[model samples]
Target: MESFASLFAGLGLFFIGIRYIGSHLKRMTGRRFRRAVAAATRRSGTSAIVGVVAGALTQSSNAVTFIAVGLVTAGLTEVRRAAPLVAWSNVGTAGLVLLAAMDIRLLVLFLLGLVGFAYYFDVERSARWRHVVGALLGIGLLFLGLQYIKAAAGPLRELEWMSAFLTFAGTADWLGLVIGLLGALILQSSATLTIMAVTLTGLGLLSLEQTLVLVLGSGVGSGLSVAVMAGGLSGSARQLAYFQVAVKLLGSLGVLLLFWLERDGGVPLLLAAVQALAEGTALQMALLFLVIQLAGALLSHPLQRPLLRLCASLAPPAPAEALARPRFLYDQALEDSAIALELVEREQQALLTRLPALIPADGQVAPPPAERQAVLEASQEVVAEVERFLSEVVQRSEGDEALERAMNFKSRNALLQALCETLDELMTALDTSNGSAGPPPLSVNLTEAAHALLDSLMEAGGEGEAVDPQLLRALTADRSALMERLRRDLLRNGADLDADQRNGLLAATALFERLVWLIHRYAVLLPDSLAEGISQKAPERAST
Candidate 1:
């Protein structure tokens, strides 16, 4: 009973360590880590390498798998690239077992000491340094947990019940597989089960063959975990999860087949060769596991395209997904300032395109109030999301390009606000008129001017052309004339106009003048080079 408690306690600590390490590593890397993976996944070999490195460092292939899934779902990476990523992550997870096979108490102690000093110096206050300290503490806890498990399990061999159980476990080929799978399912971590197998092997409670079987089952368990984790996901995410499961199942089957063949005199041949090169039974088994994993990856590589096609057929992206979500502001790109800024600019452009629709067409019936309100609400949500995304991008911005991009985002935000305000003011003025006759000729002309300026700006921006500052100046040059004309008409018509009509006209004209100035301000604020680029692209697009 005492030994059982100790073993459970050690397992608890081990789980804690894994969680700590995975979470802290995520914090340290932020969304940039996902971005890096997306970029590296352009090539299968590089993607696999990234998978291995990420898996080894985090000791959680699930972490790597989900990251891949996220990038794929966001359309940041292709399914073919993610296929090797998942395959290699499974291979990378074996590193933990190898690390546990060594004596690393001294290393653990050093790490713990470093963590202590970090805490004492308050270095952990910084998010980046906090991740480092958390990782160190986690490693220390992992080693300490291993020691506890070793101590607790070592004495189990002395009991008669344990001795009998071990004897039966050795002869029962399927027992290890069943137990491994069940334990791993309960723990949600194959690495946890593999480490236990390693500990049990070191204590003489399990043989190398049994350890191998258990580890293979653990691989299957990890695959199932991925599937379960991805259950709620759709589109590319679900496909990526299934791909991971397939890869792990293939690896497990390959290893099991090799074990079956080894029993038929093939073992003696390979064991003889491995024994000559490897020193320990556990080490030999770990090497075997890694080799089988690599073989499985190679075997699975050819199926990448088929798997992708299968996933696409199985789960096509929903049509409403684009409308329901922010298409360009993906979290994966948020850490890359260039990509993120571009995405923000794209979304801002989209928002601007909707502005013209809010303007009432001459003689057209007004849209229902409910419909207008809904549109405004949706626009506000998009505005909030874009602002948050830009804030994240700016936090990571450093270079001149990033700085310029941030400034551009700010200017675009200002323009969007002005556009929304202008729309609201126009709506209010129309309401004040009690939905009476159409807007006066001056108001109509002002609306036309605003629409033209908006359309021209959007077109020039889209074409990568700088709006000639002179052209913008010309557009706003008539603003003073329009304002004076509106005021004169308001006074001359004051006796004929109701108090509400007078107020509405004044507010509407004032808002229109503000809109013109806002546009001019944004255009002027744009850097010379970008303005030049836009101007240069404009004529080409027009000619084409």
Candidate 2:
């Protein structure tokens, strides 16, 4: 129990370190990863290598899989070409496991203390350096944890139960394979399970053969994580995960076949057959593992389409109404006035998240109503949620300061509702084709310029924190000026274009002007109470 505790603590720290290191590495290499994912769609051999290399460096198959999934979902890549990424990720994960299994000191603790002291000791900008140093230190702590686990497990030889288990595990191939599979499933980390197999083999309780079964099972086990991740996302994702499992099951059978062949004395078995083969020696073993992974990858591509077709065969795809889902609105974490302010900012981000579906015909910006769905839904939810949150906060707090912020919260919510109402009205007008006067035509560039100004204002309005009333007014004026300029240009060029072209241009002009009004309203929604200083120190901010 004591040993297990020590081992657990060490491993806990080690993983946290791995997480920190992974994050920094991810941020540093994100652009490269993006390009690699894009290049892989071309099916160029070099791009496939780049894909695998990035996955290994990050030590996250989930991350790579997600990227591939996004690209596929976005129609950027054919589902057929996406299979190699899965194969590449699984193989890359094997490399990460090998690396994480190495020993390292708990240097992250030392660095944390050093950074903490340096920051307090008036070292200029030391705190700013803390994040990078902390991440590096986290990597060190991760290894230290692994070391402690090793030390703790050293006592297993002295424990009767441990010895019995080990002996039983070593002697029984089927049992060992089951344990390995179950353990990997529980851990949700194939790498972690593989290291355990390697460690157990080193302790001499299990032969290399027993460990081999477990490692193979571990590959199958780690897949449970992907299954869990895909559970929330149905359709293609669910089918993809299911098919991947079938591939793994088949691959496991192949491993069993190879082992059975060796036992038949058709070929002399190497003593090292049990050990996980690497690039070092037993190139055949490495090749075998690669083959299984590649097979799984190849099988995954055609399988999804077939699976989808099979599903269709069994029961037709769900009707559009059955599968219809409401877009997820903004997070509702902003109940406290301080938190509500922050929540508004996040909701604004959510609004911008999917507004691209509405890009204008000119491709400069989205249609006004279309843009509002993403932004309006996000803003509406946030404002409503914050109002609810502030109500609770106001009831609980004692201080006048808290009370004042609550009032400001109400004002912000009102502005949010106003924006929604305005947008709803605009969309209705467009649909109704109200004989409202359309703006005059202009140069295509000028029309595009007007659309751009509107989008910027919409984006800025959604970005609630740093919003300045002066900036809002400037955007409003800029949009109005662009509309006037575009009107003049349309009159100048209207005669040059064919009649059909002229009609199309006029329709586009009307849509762009309406969108401009929508954006301008977003800027106008910013009340004095919504800005940072005003809400935070209500009395002081008001005075300023």
Candidate 3:
């Protein structure tokens, strides 16, 4: 009972320390880490190095994978570029496993003692150092937990039940594989399972061959866990997850085949190589874990193109992902300021075209809330990309004309972003007003007005149609007086409307009015030829 309790306690501490370390390190690195990942993708080698560093720091490949996914989703990096980072990060996770193989009992004690002193002096209270202290404490706890597990091994081996289980588990190599897989699935971390296998091997409870098979299973299990957890993701994100799954499965299974060859056919492969390189069961297991990760990297790196194709086929880019990607802006354009500014303009216009989709056209049914939100999110993503593209243009631009055009594009981009946000809020307000009870008469009118205004803006911004500044100025003219009168009348005569409906109606009208003003401002910023007379006249009318 005491041994069982110690084993469980050790497992608990091990998991807790991993969680603390991963979570705190993530918080500590935060945006800077993300930026590093985003920037590192310029070169394959740099990205790989960053990936390894990320895995080492967080001690979690899953976290690193998601971070890469997020960067891809944000248009900060391409899926192809992010693939190396995700692949190499597995190598970084081996650092902890290797550390565990060594005799670090004194080191663990010293770390725990240092953590105690830190707490005693209130180092954890400092905002900057709090995460540092927490991560250090997690390290101490992690190794201390390892020590506990190792200590309990002797007592566990003395038990008849444990002895029988170990003997049964080692009788067939495949059985150990299954055990490792299940253990990793339950723990959601292969490293944790592999470490346990390492400890058991060192204690003579399990053979080195059993530990090898178990590590292979744990590797494959880790991949399965990622695939299962990321099931809900789609598009490039899903593709990236699939890439991770491929790396793990291929690497582990490939090595497993070699192990089988060595054991059954008298072939000298990974097992022979591992035995030749390292002594002792624990050290050999750690080296094998690293070798498996390296094999995965080595095997997958050469087949990157085919693997990426496979991943894409398995999880094709969703329509929203396609929409979110910038269609016009490319890095190469940045070299030529003129081309960069032109691309920015084209991208902004593309975004401008998406604005009308926020509201359905005449006689078309309004899209469901989920569809609407997806469209809005796609537009927002493109807006972010445009902003980033323009910033780069600003830095590279040389002369006044180029600089002025970039500034003009920036201001226009800002207006477009505002318009997107207003439309989003307007949709929410309209949805609220059109409750389950049905659309109120005021809601119906507001919806129609929004549809007509968005149509006019779309036409004016379209490529084929020449910008009719006067027409836009009149269309988007101040409707404050009209909205105010409508509001007053609704309060007096809206008897059927509940409080929620009434508030929704009021908010919708206010957002619609602001929407019109934003359109007017956007028109005034149009080119001199387009805004010829209205730019001079619209501001005065808009002030009223």
Candidate 4:
């Protein structure tokens, strides 16, 4: 009973320590990590190195996979470049597994002592160093827990139940693989399971062959775990997750076949190679775990194209993901300030065109709430990309004309972002107002008016269309007085409206007014000669 208690406690501590280390390491290096990933160009080697670093820092392949997904989704890098990063990250996770195989008792003591003094000094309270301190503390707890598990293992081998279980697990190589798979599925950490297997083998509770099969099974199980967790994801993001799954499964099963051939056919293979490198059973298992990861990377790299095609067929890109990617603005355009600014304008116009969709069409049934939210979020993402692109243009702009155009686009981008936000608020207000009695009559009218204003702005601001500034100014004219009067009338005459309905109506009206103002501001920033042939008829007016 004492041995069981110690083992469980150690496992608990190990799990907690891994969680802290992964999470804090992410928080500590997140921005720099993102920048590193974004900086990955067409060079496959650069991306692979980034992936290795990401895996090492996070100590989890799953983390690296998702970070790559996020970067791809954000248009920071392409799926092809991100693919290598995801593949090599698995290799990086082997660092911890190798570290765990060696003697770290003294290192554990040093870490705990340093952490103790740091905590006493309240280093955790400092924003800059908190993550560092927390990560170190997790390292201390991780090895300390390993020490406890090792201490418990010797006594545990003497137990009748434990002996029976070990005997059963070793009866067949396939059964050992199953045991490993199940353990990884439950724990969601193949490294953790592999480390435990190393511990058991070192204590003579399990033989090297049994431990190898277990490690192989854990590899496949880790992939399955990622697949299960990322089930909700779709499009390129889902494809990346599937890529991880492919590498893990292919690598682990391939190594398992090699192991069988060496053992049965007397062929020298991975087992013999590891034996030559290390003598101890624990060290050999660690080396094997690493070999399995490398095997996955090596096997999957050349097959990435076919595997990606398979993934795409299984999980096609979602509409929202397609919508989120910027239609224009490539890196090469940045070399020429003129071309880059033009691309920024085109992208901003594309974003503007999406505004009207936020409001449901009248007389037609409203779009699904999930569909609408996806569109809104996609627009926000594009808006962010536009802002980033414009910043690059600002840095490259040389003269007054180029600088002026860049600043103009920047101003318009700001207004466009404001319009998206205000429209979102307006939609939320309208949804809230639709109670048991349905939306108030005033809310319905306000939505229709806002929709009409959006249509006009879309036309006037659209590509190759000359904007009549005076006409646009009239179209988006301030309606504060009209809205205020309507609000007063609603309070005086809207007796049937519940409190929620009345508040919703007021909020909707306020947002609509702001929406109109934003549109007007956007129009005022439009260039005089929007298209080649068309000329500005209205007098030039100062930008408000």
Candidate 5:
């Protein structure tokens, strides 16, 4: 129980350290990672090499493979590109295993020292250092665990049951292979199993040929882990896992045939290759066996596209998001003055539709993930369609009043355009969120500041302002002001912000205010001779 508790504690610390490493890595390498992932999944060969490097660095192919699977399921990566990486990952593990087997007891000592350093380090002063130190400590514990494993296995070698098992495996290669494969599958640790194979062989209880069969089986059995993990994954993801199984199984079959050649009178050369590493230390022999495994990495390139096709066949049909409600003011049959003014008014209303929900609906305490994504995408399309439609209206503006109102709508809605974009970002974060992210307090204050300005302006009702360039200047200034405030707030508070997020909140206060101000300009444009009492009314506006 003590040993198990210690192991679990080590694991707990290791995962926490990995989380820190991944977080820092994201900030430092997000742009580079995007390009790298794109390049990887585009071609099977490159993907394979990348996978090997990634597994080697992280020392966990499961994590790398799962990432590849998720990307494939999301349709960002093709299965073909993913297969090569999966193949290369097995080869990568061999290198890591060899390193672990070597006497680098320094790993454990360093970790013990780092725990002391990290425990005393100041967080703000040593944020990045803390993560690095923590990660190093975790790696050290893992190596130390291997040392303990080596110690534990030492006694098992002397047991009568163990001696009998070794005798049975040495003489019966097929049974030996089956036993090796089953042990790895059951233990779920190829490294641990490899260590066992090496330790037993070193103890003189198992011959090189017996250990070699087991080594080969370990590679083949490792495929089962991914298959089980992929069960809940989508079709594209499952195909990625299945592809790994197929590649490993096929490789295993080739090894089986090589065994046949050696057993019969077929290939002396193949038999010689199999015997080369059989006489060495189990750890060294494990390294040599890995060379055979490394060939799979190269093989993965050729098999990439086949995997992609399989994933495509298995993937669920892609979801489409094209149906959106359009927002237009009353029809154009009204007078030229009324029509242009109404169009601007109608577009303004359309843009303001999501304000009540979006203004308070966002922050750290977000709305439902799916609903947020839908609203965001929906808002973007609305803004874009409005912009395109109004660009034409801007071209059709006739007199000073009509032309002015149209231009005013163009600018105000431009602010809405920003809102639409920001809302989309908030939605994406909310959709993927765990809901403990709390609130974006700074952004909330910025939004409230904006609403206050809008209310102030509306309550002031464009008093004493005329249709001169000053009116245009005021509208544009408000737009710029609100956007700047939102931008500043977001810069300070936006840890994981997406695009549409800041824009959505900014739109409510800045863009909506500008729209109302512009309409007030339009109302002013009507000739005193032709218009009556319109210029005297107060403005009451709502921003979508």
Candidate 6:
């Protein structure tokens, strides 16, 4: 019972260390790392190498996978290029297991002590060193936990029940596979489970063949865990998770085939290769894990397109769901306020782009209420998410420059939210206009004003072309004059419009004027920095 307790506690500590290490590494290098990875995706070979390095640094393949998914979803990288990234991430995660398999207890301890003393004295004043310190601490804890786990397992070799279980696992490949799957699922880390298997091998409780099957099962189990987490996500995100599963599943099958061939008096190629390079049982098992992932990546390289098609076919994205998602707001960017603020600016512009779709086209009926509602709801949700993200950024930010930028971003977010509300009201008024026998005189003016504003917005968003102050002043004056004239005409010909007609026209006039004014205000407030980031081609303005 004491041994079991020690083992569980050590496992818990190890898990925490792995999580801490991955998260801190992400925080430290997320922005630069993402940009580098995005640039490297021009070819699959380079992307795979980047993936391997990123996964090793972060100590978690899932972290690397999410980064790839985020880059793909953000339009920074193509989905096709992301396949090798996912493949190489699996290879990279094997590195941690390999490192853990080695007996580097003394060196790890010495480094931990050195870092701890430096941190204690605050020797490095830079904030960046804090993350480095945290990462070293995590590494230290990880190595210490392994030591505890080994000590606990060492006693188990003398136990009767433990020996019996190992005997069963060695004899039954399926049982070993099942045990490995369950262990990995419970731990939420295949690397952790693989290290435990290596410890068992060192204890002479498991054969190399049994350990290979278990390791293969651990790979599948990691994929299963990712699949379960991605169940609710749609589009490329869910597809990326499925892609991971396919690689592991195919790799596991290949290993099984190799096992069968070896059993049939064929060349035990894997064993021979491992024996040629590695000595100890644990090192040999570690070598086998790496060989499996390497083979899997090489085998899957040519099937990238077919595998991507299969993932999409299995979990196709719903159009509605995709629209509702916050496209430009990525969690990875949150680590850097500058990048996060830029993303918020981009998302605000994206929200603005949706507005023109609601403008009623000439000779066209108002859009259906369902369509209008969908656009409105999606717009509102993204705006809300952006606001929330900005709030988080503000809370985490330091220094005058970062705080100032966050404040400006918050202001822009508020303006976008107001614009969305005003546009929704205008859409309602346009729908009401359809009920009239003929287009009201004010409706035509409102449509023209909207079109003009939409065109100005597109030009500004695309080419960094600001709406001319002179043009804005002219449009504002024209809208005010038109509103004044409509009021006098309604009074002069009071009997022409019934109570309902009068109220509707008056409401439409109010919404249209407010919408135009809001657009003008937004154009004036548009920051030059944000305008420079928009795409080069101007988007088509909605016709009215």
lDDT of each candidate versus the true structure: 0.73, 0.55, 0.84, 0.84, 0.56, 0.75
* Candidate 4 structure quality by residue, lDDT tens digits, 338-357: 98987887888788777776
Query: Compared with the true structure, what per-residue lDDT tens digits does model 1 show for residues 150-210?
Result: 9898888899998888788878768878887777777777777777777777777787877
Q: Is candidate 1 or candidate 6 better by lDDT?
A: 6
For model 5, what is the error of residue 287's alpha carbon versus the real structure, in angstroms, after optimal superposition? 2.1
Worst 10 residues of 6 by lDDT: 535-544
lDDT accuracy of residue 450 in candidate 3: 80
Candidate 3, residue 259: CA error in Å? 1.2
Q: After superposition, how far is residue 359 of candidate 2 from its true place, in Å?
A: 20
TM-score of 2: 0.52
* TM-score of each prediction: 0.66, 0.52, 0.83, 0.85, 0.52, 0.71
**Measured by C-alpha RMSD in angstroms, how accurate is candidate 3?**
5.2
Lowest lDDT sum, 10 consecutive residues, model 4, at 535-544
Tens digit of per-residue lDDT, candidate 2, span 384-471: 5455445665666566876675665456456556645544553443333323344223433434454455455544554433455446
Preferred candidate (TM-score higher): 2 or 4: 4
Report the C-alpha lDDT of model 3 over 1-544, residue by residue, as the tens digit.
8877888898889888888888898888687678778889889899999988998887778888999988888777888999999998999999989988888888888888988999999999999899999998988888878778878767767889988887887678788778778888777778878877888788887888889988898988888888888889998998898999899988898888888888889989877887898888899999999989888877888999999999999999987887888888777788999988878877777777776666866577887778777878888888887888888889989999999989888888788888888988998898888767778877877788888776666656644345575678888888899999999998899888778788888899899999999888877766647555546767877999
- Candidate 3 ranges with C-alpha deviation above 4 Å: 117-130, 328-346, 361-371, 385-418, 421-445, 455-478, 488-507, 517-530, 533-544
Q: How accurate is candidate 5 locally (lDDT)?
A: 0.56
TM-score of model number 6: 0.71
Q: For model 1, how many clashes?
A: 5
In terms of lDDT, model 4 sits at 0.84
